[model samples]
Target: MKNKSIQIQEKHHKDLQKLSESLGQSYGKLVEKMILYFKRTGIDPDDLKNESPSHKIQQLDKRLVSFLKVQERDILKPLRQETYEYYQNYDKTLKDAKANINKNLGLLDNNSEIRANHILKELAKQRKALITLSEHLDPANKKGLKTVFQNIFKNAN
Candidate 1:
């Protein structure tokens, strides 16, 4: 590359020289790197001349916060609302299913009680029939049959 010169203040040149020495780089190399950095970052050198580094950082922070707020408004809020609605529907469905199950269990308990009552009624009828049959038998056989029937009824109770 051909060597070129540009006019700058003596104080700025001295400052650049001091920075170059501190960074252990040649003055020309430091200038080249600064130009490359500005191009790569898409920041104008003229704008940098007017703003301090802290001011630039503060502006970037504000822009980032604004962008995040916009994202929350556009994306996160709707998703959270949708999730809440889904959970509400799911909870309602679960409650309905639980109620149905409880109703069915109540029906089963009622049915079991009815069946148990029917069985006890049939056993009572059979015991009465056996007692009448024993009275028609001979005394010796009637006594043995009476004891057996009594034992059977006792165990059933």
Candidate 2:
């Protein structure tokens, strides 16, 4: 048997209790998952480690929203460069469909594309984050983080 020690905040006590009951698993088991995940990967698991969903965390998330936006820009760089070359090679006859999308739909004006790109980028970003968070969390924590993201995203819409 493996026994692990974890620090849980009282602020999340209610949520922990609720989860303990809903999952029919002890809080320890839940935390175990996060621990193992972090050990295997180098991502920070504590990114989701919050005792409460306070206004401060929300504000920080607001900032992360921009960071992800920047990352999305970075992700598109290679694609954009290649597309630009292709356009140049075609003498402007062929247009980049994604650029056309940006123009015709006005998606970027509303941050929809940016948000969508962030989500797409999160797939890769979260891996490292999950691994890191795992150091402070476990499988249970990973699920909790996923749940947080789900709730945050669901509420955004």
Per-model CA lDDT versus the true structure: 0.87, 0.72
Error of 1 at 13 (Å): 4.8
RMSD of 1: 12.8
Candidate 2 wrongly placed segments (more than 4 Å):
1-7, 48-157
Off by over 4 Å in 1: 1-13, 26-58, 109-157
Candidates in order, TM-scores: namely 0.45, 0.24
lDDT over C-alpha atoms for residue 157 of model 2: 56
Candidate 1, poorest ten consecutive residues by summed lDDT: 134-143
Q: Give the per-residue lDDT digits (tens) of candidate 2, residues 1-157.
A: 7776657688778888888898888888866765786687655756675345377688899999999888878877778899999879786545566568768887446588789889988875876575566545656664576567556656755
- Please report the TM-score between candidate 1 and the true structure: 0.45
Let me know the TM-score candidate 2 reaches against the reference structure: 0.24
How much is the lDDT of residue 114 in candidate 1? 93
- Tens digits of per-residue lDDT for model 1, 33-132: 9999888877776774767679989999999999999999999999999999999999999999999999988878677999999999998998998966
